[model samples]
Target: MLSAEEIHEIEAEAQHYPTREAVLIDALRIVQSHRGWVSDDALRDLAEFLHMTEADLDGVASFYNLIYRKPVGRHVIHLCDSISCWIEGYAGVRRALAARLGVDFGETTKDGRFTFLPIVCLGCCDRAPAMLVDGELHVHLTPDNIAGALEKYA
Candidate 1:
């Protein structure tokens, strides 16, 4: 499920680890970096390589919010839903985004261009109602400006 280059990269990183179990997160990240998202086959291979049960590895993988288990679009939209954002009109921002993308959180656009997801925070509380589009942070959002900000990603 992993390519030679990916295995080589993962093994090189694994050298610094005390044991295969310690390398769990990095191994999964390596697989995700190469494959976009970790498939069942890839997870199985990783479990074997790490000498851990698939269930154990899956638990770890699922715990990390950044690790995607299913296919995602080219761009991932992470909307902050923390109290600061909530107080700063997060509902309007979310509504605007939902209307713009025609997809709700945990759903991907039908055109496969974007995936909308909710994150706890982006640590931009001063600039509340922030969102990250493919890692580019947009803060102090309003419904009017959100669409323009997303145009670059589209």
Candidate 2:
């Protein structure tokens, strides 16, 4: 359940949107920022708060790729897997990094410091073989760059 203050805060966000329905995404984002994924209770609360049905809220949330409906790693490492990246060395780079980290894609490290995921396009096709770690983009990556890059967050 959301705190009274939290609900009030969300109400302010709700007002900013042209319609209460518009607040659904942002409110769910707020919930995810706090709790990781969109839990059943959070979905129900969001539905009630936004005057939406649970199914309606779920539908919108599921439609968006960025919205995590399940648990994600504390530090998400998104590697670009688009055509440009594939033409580069992203495949080998991804494999080597996974070997070094000892976790498959979408799996979190035991220390919980990292989780590897794939991104369809980083929007930097020119910098094919790029990745985003903790929201910071690292372009033109190689296997050699992985350890040093991981150090920045460590």
Each candidate structure's TM-score, on Cα atoms with residue i matched to residue i, is 0.93, 0.87
- Tens-place lDDT per residue, model 2, 55-144, is 999999899877888777777888888889999999988998899888988798898878888888888988879999977999888988
Q: Model 2, residue 68: what's the lDDT?
A: 82
Per-model clash counts, in order, read: 0, 0
lDDT of each: 0.91, 0.83
Between which residue pairs do clashes occur in model 1?
A: none
- TM-score of candidate 2 versus the correct structure, residues matched by position: 0.87
In angstroms, the error of model 2 at 55 is 1.9
Question: What is the alpha-carbon lDDT for the whole of candidate 1?
Answer: 0.91
lDDT of 1 by residue, 22-84 (tens): 878988888988887888999999888778899999999999999999999989999999999
